[model samples]
Target: MTGGLPLSGVRILDASHVLAGPFATYQLCLMGADAVRVERIGGDDFVRHHGGSAELRTQGMGGSFAAQNAGKACILLDLKAPGGRDVFLKLAAACDVVMENYRPGVMDRLGVGYADVKAMKPDIVYCSLTGYGPQGPFADAPAYDHIVQGVSGLMSMTGTKDSGPQRMGLPITDYIAGLTAALAVAGALHQKRATGEGQHLVVPMLASVLAFMGSYAIDAQTLGRERGLQGNAPFSGSPFAGRFDTVDGHLVVTANTAAQAVRMVRALGLADLEPLAAGTAPDALSEADRARVAEALDRTFRTRTALEWEEALGAAAVPAGKVRGLGEILAHPQTAAMGCLDDLPLPGLEDPVKLPGLGFTSDAWTRRPLSEPEAPGQSTRDVLAGLGLSRREIDDLARAGAVAGPGLPPRSA
Candidate 1:
């Protein structure tokens, strides 16, 4: 699986948990990095016990955890316990990257912060994912995806003005931070390869979201104007570019350009509205003109089903798509052809678990075959053994409460 992959031979110690941290390491894992998840003894990651699947959640392999945790080894280590810190240092010395998402100074308090790990492995790519940066007024402030979305001003622009601020349906900020961290780590690794030097990377969810809304943020700051909530309307302000209802369902259209707007109206059999849409600029129409054009589009779109309109508008080279549910899109043939999902056999499950794969394909690199998401500490003994600990040593550590996992001796009362 590692052959010809970009991250082959790369080793990462993932001490991070939950969405953002775990997702970053997962991306690297898909690229062929060998990732080892270091979980606390008797304390599982939050996602391991919570997700959409009740059965899987009870088994401590919830859907959220399973989605991003495949292709990694799991090891339990009570870093506070005796001999635990020593074991962590040993693994650090052998790994190329160390990832964590604890609040600022939490790792320092635990004696495994960047400085500590860097002492063990001088040229290690250490990344810290947090809500804010390492040092800031909000550095210690708690944050979740929704909170960051609001704080980053993303919520301000979502939904309709009448509906007020709205959070996105998914944890978009967390995923953005995860992606940013992954890219930063990849870049740091490249620099390390060239200069034999390593560096610390700090990825903040709030900053990631702000960066994602870069143009909007800059416009708001420079022009003192806010797009606010315009519902499904695009920033282009084209009357033809927005969500419209069809006979059976709804679809979104993005006919921002004059030509595309003309094509869209013509495709919908509204040639009379073409003059209103053929303006040189998106906002060229007056409010009255815009209202007239929109009303016409609204009424014309209702003549066909959303899918029918999608096909018709698409054939005319106008950007449009039927609004679809997650399940519907996942089952669509277009999605299947993209190879963006994989089914892996989980150990205790009767059927293979369907999880998302890489977002894109490339001719230069192929992802590794995904492994099943493991139970907490599922590979503890094996990982310790790989660190050169003997079977007796592993059992001693388990019994001493330094580690816990399957295949380890039960800790004495």
Candidate 2:
């Protein structure tokens, strides 16, 4: 590719955990950045658990963790302790970026805020992902993905008219904020290259979620029309395409262009479905006729299962699809054909770890995936050596309760 794993030499100190922050760092790792995830000294990142067996919990990982922390190194550090904070600062001096998802002032309270690190490394790019921006009345209010959806007006706009205030099933807000953070950090990196200075970024999940609802927000402002949910339908104020319940599961048929819509309606034996297509503009379809055509097509789609509709519509060159459950999609042959998942053997994670495999190469596609996530603090000794902490220094820190590594799971296969 033109960029050569563009961030090849970059170093990221990931103080963030959970979905958004860790996923962002995972993307960085794919781009060839050296991202070290710093965890609490008492244990590893708590993202590893959600009430599975104790052995699974002790392995300190789950499917969720696999998706987020796939390509980052885990280093145990107690930011609250004096020695731990010192070690973090030393690592900061060697890094290009620092990421955190703490409530607004938590890092400052720990004496490792942007100011502290900017002094040590002036060109550092520090990004903060939060539920709300810093310096607001709700700055300290705790937030998870679902809460952000409710608070950001996303829940109000989701689902059908009867099912009001439905939260998104996926973590949409978190992923959007992570993508925004990555974009901001990339921009800041470019500026730092020219100006020899760093920038502090504070992006909130609520704001990111709100941005995703731009069309609704715009309509409310300009048309004075309140947004309404229509369930699995686009808000383009047109029903050119809608979700249909097929023999098995569902399929969404979208023909955004009038020509495509014409092709679809003809293919479905509903040639007279819409009004005056030969006279109207290419992108414009009449409301009454469009509704009739959509209803006719909906009935036609129900004649077959989702997969059948998918293949038939694909042959007609129309955009149609069936949404697959995560597990089903993961196990499908296409997952391996596209090379999206790989089972990399790990030291302790019970099953061979499912490493995320995604990256684009101009030459072709990539088959060389990153190694799996290391066992917690697996490189503690080597990292301590790089930090110039002698074995005696490390022993002193260990004795002072400044460090620890992953304890093994009790039950073995």
Which candidate number has the best TM-score? 1
TM-score, structure 2 vs. true: 0.87
What would the per-residue lDDT of candidate 2 be over residues 288-326, giving only the tens digit for each residue? 666665677777877888998788778888788887887
Runs in model 2 lying further than 4 Å from the true structure: 1-4, 43-45, 51-56, 274-295, 331-359, 364-368, 406-413
| Candidate 1 similarity to native, TM-score | 0.96
Best by lDDT: 1
With a 3 Å backbone cut-off (N, CA, C), the pairs that clash in candidate 2 are: none
For model 1, state the Cα shift of residue 254 in Å. 0.5
Error of 2 at 386 (Å): 1.0
TM-score of each: 0.96, 0.87
Candidate 1, residues 62-86, lDDT tens digits: the string is 7788888887899899999888888
Q: Compute the lDDT for candidate 1.
A: 0.87
